[model samples]
Structure formats: C-alpha cells, structure tokens
Target: MGKRSRWLLWMVVAVGVVGVVATGSNGGAGEGEGKGKVLEPVVTRIAFGSCANQSAPQPIWNAIIDFDPQVFIWLGDNVYGDTKRPFKLFGKERTFGPWKNAPRFIPSSPKELESRYLKAKSNPGYSRLRDTTQRSRWLLWMVVAVGVVGVVATGSNGGAGEGEGKGKVLEPVVTRIAFGSCANQSAPQPIWNAIIDFDPQVFIWLGDNVYGDTKRPFKLFGKERTFGPWKNAPRFIPSSPKELESRYLKAKSNPGYSRLRHTTQVIGTWDDHDYGLNDAGKEFGGKITNQKLLLDFLDEPQDSPRRKQEGVYTSYMFGPVGRQIKVILLDTRYHRDPLRSDGSVLGSSQWTWLEKELNGPKSAITIIGSSVQVISNLSATTRPLFSLESWGRFPKERNRLFKLIADTKREGVFFISGDVHFGEISRYDCATGYPLYDVTASGLTQAVEKAVPHVFSLIVRFVAWLTPTTMRVISKNCRFRSCTYGQPNFGAIEIDWSTAPVTLKLEVKDIVGYPVTGVKFSLVELQSRGSVPSVKAGEHRRHCSLEVNLRWMIKYRLAILFYCSVSALLLAMIGLAYAATLAFRLFLHKCKLD
Candidate 1:
C-alpha cells in the first residue's frame, strides 16, 4: 500500500476508536450498565458528625460547608461544655505553685453551658455552616435565647400554668365553645365577627389559621383564571421562619380576630398549611423553627412547657365539677408519619399523653380537638384516587384511640375536628363504646366552592352526595345533598344545664350564626354502657361504608360502563396493530427472497 492509503486507513481506525470512547463516556456501556449509578455532583448530599470541641480549632467546618451538603445532622455533643478545670478544694490553704491539686473534670453549670454555646455560635466557621444550612437547622443562639425567655416567663415556681390549664379558660362553667379552621390571611375574615357574636366562652382554632405556604394563583381546570403569563407560576415559597412570621402577623392583625381574641379565650392547634408545608409530616426539615413561630403567634408565654416540647398537645378544664368541660387539643403535625404508611398520626409520646388525659380528672363533657377528622374517613366513600389528611388514613392509630376510650370508659366524649374544607357532623358507633360524634367545621374564609368556578357547583354537590358517612342531617340549610355545608362556616357546641337531662347541641353554623346542620341529644346519651335512644331509633349507623343510592348509581352506570368498554376496545386495537406489523414484515422478507 502507498503512504496515502496507509494514512487514510489509520484515520478511519482513529475515528472508530473515538466513537467507542464517546459511547462509554456517555454511559452507553459500562460496569453494571450504569443503570442506578450516580455520576459526579450527586443530587442529594448528607453530612453528619459529633463531638465537636468548640474551644479547640474548628477547621473542619469550612471543609464541611464547602462540600455543600443539602442536610447536615449534628448528632450530639456539638460543643464540649462538660469540660475539665483545676479545682482548689482547700480554699486559700497556701497550695504550692502547680503541684498541690490536679485538674478535675466536671460538667458545666447552666450559665456556663449557655456561655459556651454562645461562644460556639459566634465561631466564624460554624457561622458559615449555619448560613449554608439556614433552611434546615434552627440557629443555636436563637434556640438558647428562646430557652432563656421560657425560663424567665415560667419562673422557678412554675407560675406559667404548666399542665392542664395551660390554655386560657374564660368561664367557670363553660356552656358555649366556637371553633373553625382554614382561614386565608389575605382574604376577608368576617367569620371571626360572627364567632364572637355567638358569645362563645372559648374559641378553638383547629388549623390552617393562615396561608403561610401557598403559592401559585387560584387555578380552574389547570389554568390560571387571572390575566398574566406567570399566573400559574409560584408567587412565593416560604423557606425561612421570617416568611411564616409575617403571615402570622398579618392574620393576627385582622381586626375581627383581634376583637374575638379579647372577647373570648383563644386556643389553637396547627394543620399542614400553617405547619409550613402542605401535607407535611415529621420529615419536614424546618419544623423546629416553625414550631417556635406558631407558638409566638398563639402568644404562648416565653417559659411555657409547650415551647420546649416536641408537639403542642395540651388539655384544659373549665367550670365546676358537676358541669365541667375538658378540651384536649392534639398536635397532629409535629410527629406525624407519612400517609398510606399506616405508621402513626400521633407519635408514641403523644399517644401516651392522650391516654393519660382521657383517664385524668372527670368532666361532664370531654371534647377532643384533632386537626384532622377522627371519625369521618372520606377514603371509604370518595374515589380511591383522592387522599385526604385525616386519622382515617392511619387505621391502626384510629382503632387504638377508640380502644383507649372504651378501656377508660370516658363518658361524654366527642371529637371536634377541621381540615376537610366543609362543615358536617359524623358519628361512629361500632368500635367506639358510644355514639362517637365528630363535628367538623372548616373554611373560616376559604371554602371549596369559592376555590372553583361557580359552574362546578353542581359537580361539587354531586361528589359530596356520593360520599355518605354516618352524617347527621337536619333541615335544608345543608344545601348539599350529603348534608355538607361547603360555604364559610364554624362549629358551635351548646350545653343547656337548665334542661331535665342536660341537653347538648352540636351545630355547624353559617357566618351569621344560623344553624346549617345540627344534632340535639342528652348528656346521658354519651355513656359507654348506656343505651343510646338515637341508635335504637335506627339513625344513620353505616360509618364509612360504600352504601349509596341505587338510583344514582343507575343514572351514572352508562358512564362507568363506557370506561370498561373503551378499555376493551383499546386492547383489541393493539392486537390488530401488532398482527399488521408482523404481516408487513413477512411480506417484506418474501419480496427480498423473490
């Protein structure tokens, strides 16, 4: 071969080698076929360490920050506060220069530990780590400062009301309690004025007290109704405590809420939106900082035990012994495991606390406040595609709660909940000892009907009707066929001690304090072994079953059958397409042979 031919052959060989190298670099073929392998710059990086001696050099912090971990877990002993120091046991006993006594290792006093923590916080290297991980970790100095404030407010004698009376109790014999949830701070909250007009002795906030975490404009049919290109885009994302604090301030500053706060004792627990994330659970990183912000909004004392605790669960007793009412507010956000895991809604600690509260001091009426519905499980009647936040999602936990109530035989027990964005009353009588009632009031300013277009009102009504529980239905005030009021509403409980048997009324009322739906019963009807007359009378007892109207199913049967027929038709078409492709390939092969 000539020189030019040899040169061309070498060039072709070089190009082939380059192609092979490119394929390997692009992960076309490699060890393990590169299926689950992660390349450089991994998406999520986590770093953790312990036993950081703040007094000594902290050069490792700079390198750790440089690594840019998405999460940095400080296991324990972030600072060496329990340090060793030389002690002179015999004070002023004329010890020799340095050979008299040896150094002793002693844990630091509270003040000294605090000073060491402050010193560690001021370290420049640690400050860089804090700046990088600001979204996840609460600042060490801020937590310490809050602790100091808590101690000062609580005092040595525990003057801040440590236990059951931690919440405000306005009445000696409480007869009226008003509660609601799901209020948007930016919207007009006239419902507060109505709640105050009812003259409720106590007011409870179930959750979603403010829309701190919402972004994106209200959309209808997946399109923004507002006139802007970025209307569908997220307007704001709350990543810091400041954002949540500002929203809380806006809600607290509402004139109506302020007046209600003064007129009645206000107490509350949080749901997902106010808890800093939608559908968030124990896994949310900023929960510690956000908890402080929530307590601040509630005007919790600087030294309240709630500040130091992991959750905000607490109980309050009002009135004298004969007419006493106990309100137990549960914190469902802080330690809640994820949905569908069947893990836990209330963590083990909260559950233990709940059992104690249930078995604690006797009261004529015991009201348990859960941020999510306890008795009404929408999953049973609503389509399986939809998932709502409720205790129903955790079946084991729900059963345990019921069994606890039965074992304790806590009489006059009923649940008040919010978060479903509608007003209704549910009752369960099977596992529970008595007719367990859950009065749910939601949408103080934000309602489901308002979120969608007016044209979709009928569809919303239909969906509500299809979802049937042991819902207590009164007159036509519950405009929905399923006895659910979707407009702005609140729940009210009234106890008439003047009656012979002491009548109790549970109501879901509108903005003007008009009863939308309610139930009237005697206090004796809530006993564990007592025979409830309402149940004997054959009231709605199927709690969370698939029972629905046969006529309604017949009306929609054609639509349901169409889905099945279309699925079969698609399968037939796919088979025909596969046969046609095979026949075409055979024809091509035969033509090539000819």
Candidate 2:
C-alpha cells in the first residue's frame, strides 16, 4: 500500500480504539459476558408522580397503563380541595386600598372541599385506570397461585408423574411500583390514562395528595402590612380537620382512585397541603385530627399501630430473600418544624423508627420516600433570591439523617421526593459511603411549565439555569438548559435482577409515560464500602465541591474523549492532505525539468 494509504489505515485504527474505550467505560454493568451465562430477571418496577389536579383531564394515565407497571405511588396532592376564592367579610367583599378588591384568596369550606374531591373521583379516565390496575392484580395473583401449586404437585411424587411435570406456568417475577404528588382536583388531569396504562401493581403517594391549604396574602398599608383586618392575619390559615376530612372523602370517592384502591397496592405519606396547611408543622393546632383524616383516606386498618401513631410515617417490605425491597415512607409535614428553624423534620419518635427500619433486616434495595426534596438544596442554589421547602431548611436534621445511614452502613439506599412541581435526578456522594441518588418526580398535572406563560418561558429557563442544584444530573433528556423538566411527569424505578450486578433504572417520565431524563446504575455501586469517601460534616462543603466536579468529569469522560479523538483525527487528515498535495506538485515540477 502507498505511504499515504498506510497512514490513513493507522488513523482509522486509532479512532476505532478510542471509540471502543469510550463505549466500554460507560457501558452498563455485566456487558460482554461469556456465552450461556445464566442472567437474572427484572424483579421489580415502581412508578410515581406528583402535582395532579383531580378535576382536570388526567390523560397521562393512558401512558402509565401502557408501561404496565406492577406498582403505582401517589407522592401527594392527590386532589385540590382547599383553594382560594374572592375573600368576603360577612356579606361585603373586602378591598385593599388602591388595589381595589384584588380578589383575596381563602381556603374553601370543608363541605366545598369534599364536593371537589367527589368530582375528582368521578373522572372517567381516572376510574378506568383504577379498574384496569385492579384487574391486572387479580390476574397476576391467580397466575402466581396456579404456578406455585403446579410446582408443588409436580415435586410431591419424588419422581415425575405422567403429565404433572409438564404443567408449566409462565409467571414473571417482575414487580412494578408507581408514585406521584401535587394533583389539583379542580384542574384538567389528562394524565390518568397514561398512569393506568402502566398497570403498576403498587402505587405510592409522596405528598400534596390534596391542595387543602390556600394562600392568604397580606395587604400593604401606610406603615404596616396586614391580612386585611382579619383576626389572625395569618399568611396561610388551615381549615379545620372537618374540612380536611371532607376533602379526603371526596378524593377517596374518586371512581378511578377508588377502583385503584381495590386492585393495586396503594401506599404513601403526606406533605403540607394534605396535612391541613401550607408549610405547616407540629405547630398546626389541628394536626392531631388531620392526621387521622389522612390515615383514613389511605384506608389504614382500624387496628394498625399507624392509626394510633402521632405521625403517618411508615415502612413496608416486599419480595423475599435476596431480591427483597424495603420502602420507607416519611411524613415530612406532620411533625416538621418551620423552615430555616434548624428543627427536626421526622421528629424524635419517627427518627427512632427510621433508624430501626434502616438497621433492620437487609433488603437488596432500600427506597426512602420523602414528601419534599431530600438531597437537593434549592436554597443553596437560589439563596437570597428565594427558598423552597426542603430537607436543607433544617440543616441539622438533614445531616442527622445522612449520619444515620452512614452509621448503620446500610447499602442499596436511595431517596425519592416530590412537592417541587418538576422532575429531576440528583446525586450526592460526600456524606454517604456510596453515591446517594434522589429521583424527584413532581407535577402529575400542575406543572410549572404549564403554569408559566409561553412568553416568559425564556425567563423561567434562565432562572433554572442560574439555580441548578449541585446534585442535579445534566443529561440529554433535559428540556431546559438546567436539566430540570417542568412538565407533567412521574418517576419509575425498574430493578433488573438478571444482571450480575443488579441494575436500577431511575427515570422521570413525561405526560405520555416516556422517559425524559433518567440514570441507570448497577446495584453494586450502592454498596456501603464503595469508592465514595465518607466526609466529615465540617469538611462537607469543601469535599462536596471537589466531588461534584470529579463526578461531572467521570460521567462525561467518554463523550469528552470521543470528541477530542475526532478533532485530532480531522487535524491529522488535514495535515496529511496538505503534504500529499505538495509532494504531487514537486513530482510534476521534476518531471517537466527532465
């Protein structure tokens, strides 16, 4: 071959090696296994969402049903019963000087809230979703039972009988769980069909199960601002438990939701709205009564200890043996302290319970569900400008939780949260022994993207970009530059057991049940003794910065290498082309001289 041809061949080989290295480094675990290796099967699938308006057309259910998940979770805001309307004192409308009767908002009456829940329950699409899930569960149970009986009978005789051994049941071991929060009972919820399509076996409610608290703005006066001469002048006044109870009833009565209750295993905890107020905590007067109402909506057993508990925090274990999964649902609203107060979030009793849950029997995967963002500190990203409710509000408590996990040396633990009305995935590696991931799926219906006008989308995008959490995963699925998806979305967790190291696929899906952004990691990566360093609380910030930067580099290292290699190849080709052209010209000149 000509020297130029040989050079070209070498360049091609070099590029090929670079491409292989990049792909191999980022490829999923257990790739290129030897032939005939017995692979594990996917054992569980969980799905979740938040911020849905019950009264709205919930068309997303159809897409969810298509996913055919075995479990569904409600993160909260199952409905919007407590809402603001034009404020009136006695018989006259109140006016705030200059503003001229600027439609002050107040919480709806208990009776009114209940009626709204009832309306949400009546949504045909939601009802269909519930029915479909129930039927799927029934069929699954029957299949499992038959399969078990067949296997037992076949083995009873010691030796294979005539046709007994031939009886085979093709039951799948996969389990699917779905969850979401922040639904408005009065808004168009067109996402129910998509959720129903997923056919999840279990559903979890994270929080905002209902909008039971409405904002009560204060009026600006000559020297002081006030809540329009109201007796309490409160920013947000929670309705009595009676009103909350009514709303719960209305939500429970939702035909789609009701049907879902009968078929799929539904479980969840509460956030501020469903807890009877917005950003309320242990200070709320009616917390005791509201707690009961919330439990009743969940159909908690009359004799269960949860009913007698002060808070709704609870946990559950599913599957069996090595493939088991433990789900811990936290009540962030009931006993939470005011934001920035440095007080407790789970409270003393709940904290103790949590420790036990973490230290108890081991599960292949441990999922901790919170009603608010746990790992993402939005305040840190958007400090001074504004703050969002999150675990970061109580720095002490957040640290304590992180400490508990480290102390216990637990493995396979991650977090799922809601109430932010957007979907994103975050990972923190400083405090924990391994990279801790938090998948947040919010806005079942009430999404920030829809709430904002198209004209101001650019402004919102700019804000998102400016206020990115250190943990937010900047992936290709991001609709905005910030990697935050502000649309009707839900979270799905699929555990693939077939791989040597179990694979966990975490996703934040769109209105149509399509994944917009997600992350896939092997279960072994969540081991307590993984490569991540355990940083002391004092050294958190310094280490956090270094780790975050390192993580970014590690995550995109492949892309970086690929791009660099291509650029080099192009440069080399350009140089080679120039040299060949010069050499040809010299040859022609020499020939003319001869």
Candidate 3:
C-alpha cells in the first residue's frame, strides 16, 4: 500500500473508530464478558432496538433510560464491522458475492478485533454508564424457566465461575418485552429513548443486530476485485472467526449500547449482517465460530442447548403458572437452505424442535420470534417483485408454522419479527386457532420505504413516499394500525395479568416514544378470534388500573419510611455508645486524680 493508500486505509478504519468513540463509553467489560448478579424481581420492564451504527449519535438511548426498562434487546445491526471487506459505494456489483469464491480481507486479525472491542469500551458515554449500573452476564435463555429468572454470578474478571457446586435454578418472572431491528452504527439513531420509556422486562432482538460484512475486494486483496453485471458492492462477509470477532467487539463497545447493557438485562439472536453477510445461509463456512462468538457475547452458559446445536435457536419459559410467557427465538440463518422456487428455511432438526415446542402444553401467552417477516408480501408495493427474504419466500415452511400453531390449538401464540427496515403489525388467520399477530418493528437507526436491493431501490422509495397507501396495501393483514415505514422506529408488547384473563397491548412507536399505533387483546379475545376482527386497538388497550398504581405507591412509600426508621435507630445507638465512652474516660481521669 502506497503512502496515500495507507493513509486512506487508516482513514477508513479511523472513520469507523471515530464514529463509535464519538458516541461510545470510556470503559466496559472486555471480551464481551460480565459478571451476573441475580435479582428476583416479580415483574420485568423490557426494551429492545436494532440497526445501530456504533459511530452514529444515539440520542434515543436517553429516552429509553427514562422508561426504566428492566432489560434491553439488541435485535440486530448493533454494529457494522468486518475489516476484511470494504463496502462498494457504486457499481454493477452491489451485493455480496458467493462465499466460496469470495476473497479474504486483511487487518481483521484476532488482535485487531480485540483492540476494536477495547476502544469501543473506552468511549466516554458508555464508560460512565457501564461503571455505575448493576450488571451481570450469563446464559439468559435456559435459566428462564417457568416462574424463574436464573442469573449467574459475574466474577471480578467478568466470567462465570468454574468453582465446584454450580447449579441452575428457577429465579424470577418477566412481564414486559420490547423489540426492534436494523441499526447501522454510522447512521442516525434517536429511537432508543422511546424503547426505554416503554419499559419492557425482556427485550427480544429479532435480527440484523450488526452489519458486520468485512469483505471488501480492494481491502481483501491488493487490487479492487471487479464484479459482473449482477453483483453490487459486496456485503462485509467474514471468511474467518477473527473477522467475525472484530465486528462483534466494535458493536459491544457502542456508547448507547454500553449504557443500556449496564442498566438492563439483555439477550438476543443474530441476523445476516452480524452472522457474516447479507442473505447468508447454512453454506456460510464460519457458522460454528460465529455461533460461539454470538453466544459468548450474549453470555450463554457453557452447558446451554445452543452450544449443542449448529444454529442459535432456543426457548425460554418465564413467569409462574397462570401468567407463564413462553418465548421461542428462531435461528433463521445457521442451517438455512438456498431460496429456491420451493425452498426450506429452518433445517430439519430446528423444524422438529419447533414442532415439539408448539405441540407441548402452552403458556398463558406464547411469543414466537423470527428475524424476518412471517406474513407479509410486498408484491403490492414493488413491481416485478425482485427480492424475497421473508418467510413469504418459503411458503411451505411459513404454512407449516401456521398449521402447527393451529394444530396445537395454542391460545396466546403470536409472532414478533424484525428484518425489514419498516415496522407494522400483521395478522394470519388459522383454520383451528386464533389469528396470529406478527408485530414487525425494525431499524432502530435505519429505515427505508421499500425492500428493493438495487438502484431501483431509490425509485421504489420515491414511489412509496409519493403514495403512502402503497405501503399500507402491502400489509393487508395489519391489525393494530397503519404501518410505519419512513423513519426509524420500534415495537413493544405490554402484558397485564391482574385481570381474570391476561391482556396484551401491542404498540409501534416512533423515534421519540410517541405511539404511532397500538392495539390491545384480552387473552380470551385473542383465543376466540377466528379471523381478523374489526376492533379499535386504541380503545381496547389495557391500561394500568389506578387502584394498582396507587396500591404500589403506598407500598413503596411505606418501605421507604421503614428504611428511614431503621437507619435512624442505628444512628441513635452509635451516638449513645460514643457519649458513654466519653463519660467513662472523664470518670477514669477523676478517679486517678483523687
């Protein structure tokens, strides 16, 4: 590399570094490791978002803090890393090439990745927050069984203890869940505060956690690799484990993300960007290493079922009986097949597991999460219908999922998805069960009107902007309100179990936490609805009753008073002891003089 070329290369790297550091923390747990301290809170408030550019301004984090969520979810696009490749700005070759034939990128050595993670942690904003907040790390999925919130202790070194007699047990119950996707660290993101305000107990990351494609032709090889007519700038495709680790490290050190992690319990899965490339599947050779990196980042236990699998699909049951909430996170990437005319998405074993999970006894409410849309067809919005990344591309599997829900007669089964750059709530009616509602919230930082992958994308976006109705037409089954497709946004699900039948409130909010749209469903109502019902979601939204709020306030005040009284008593005793000691000393002096 020439002096100018070397400078330019450093400049690009500096751009990513400066971008994250400008909005990052001063310090954080290194190697994506943190100690876990278990707290058994009865109800949890959760927050989730995605598509964050580590180097971008994240004002949304402030608003998220205000809501006081107990947990946060990084759906995907948490960071854009992958030093192996450079993003092609313009050309016929825009999309990533095949993995097998792709060239390897440099400067993505293990040391380089570690340095990225370390620098990201050094960002001032994240450092301050992480330092003060109570944080822990461990496998969150397997431990979250019915009525239990299992937490593992975080050693001083931010790793799990290898001491003798370590066991997993049931702990606490979760009550709130927030989720979203598609964040670019270099893009504008002001959506986090709104998520924080929503105050979810558990945040579910749908996918696209980080756009970590590092496979740049020029950066990978000495010369800029040219592409044919069909390809575009190649996505950052990491061919080795080292490149993958670098991307993750960069993401973890994001300032806004650092703060959120400090304040709340977080868990998530991966999408294309963080997994290695755009629209990658099982054919990606680095699946094993990537899985380990992702799991380690999420603090998965060594004995986690995820460790035993080739992909990152897992399930958790939370809350006690009568209020149990089962969450099933699906891995759409690891073992996925190519998108053929008749294609398969979830491989055979995952399918078997999904079937088994759905067939079993159901929770009060069951949430099935997919990184991509399960019931949306954009043929209405885009002409010629070019890209099909959603479940719509795999009709057989999609129907199988619907059929399984129907066959199980599961009452509160619903889907939460994120992958598209927009947000909406779609419903799928089942033959034997209630209609399935898929809440699609995406792009914590990045949003687009259409899903077209090429230059025509600009035109599709323009048309969608001109005719907003075109976008709504694409979501024919949307139940809550109109779709949010123009700017950054997020989605939330609030459950109230105090009533005889539990109630679920679904919401899609803008970057500032304003409710763009919302809907409510009684568990009974959700179970009975055979088809899409004409209901006003705004009116039916289950609100926290005044009685409950007031009662909680009273109890909180009493607790405070009790604490004050105890503190005062301790002070009085200390004072009394001090005075007595002084008097004794005076008496001793008098006796000696006499």
Q: Best candidate, lDDT-wise?
A: 1
lDDT of 3 by residue, 1-594 (tens): 112222222343333333333432324746423222122333366778886656667666556654545466679755545544555434554335443333444446677666656665564444433333323211222233211222122232234456422322323456678888877655545566466545566677777776666545533333343344445446355646776676667666665565455444566778887787778998887777778988876667787778888799988877655678888999999878886644678889998999899888668888889998876644322323234477867767876877777777777877888887877666654333465677888878767642345667555444443321211223333332344454577888888877777778887778887766566878886675555323242222111111111333332443455567789999999999999999999999999999
Least well predicted 10-residue stretch by lDDT in candidate 2? 1-10
lDDT of 1: 0.74
lDDT of model 3 at position 265: 54
lDDT of each: 0.74, 0.72, 0.62
Question: Which of candidates 2 and 3 reaches a greater TM-score?
Answer: 2
**Model 1 per-residue lDDT tens digits across residues 221-328:** 355443234455444455567878999999988866765554456788999888888888899887889888888887776777789989888888877657889899
RMSD of candidate 1 to true structure, Å: 30.6
Q: Show model 2 residue runs off by greater than 4 Å.
A: 1-174, 217-232, 530-543, 546-594
Model 2: how far is 364 from its true place, Å? 0.5
Worst 10 residues of 3 by lDDT: 540-549
lDDT of 1 at 420: 84
lDDT comparing candidate 2 with the true structure = 0.72
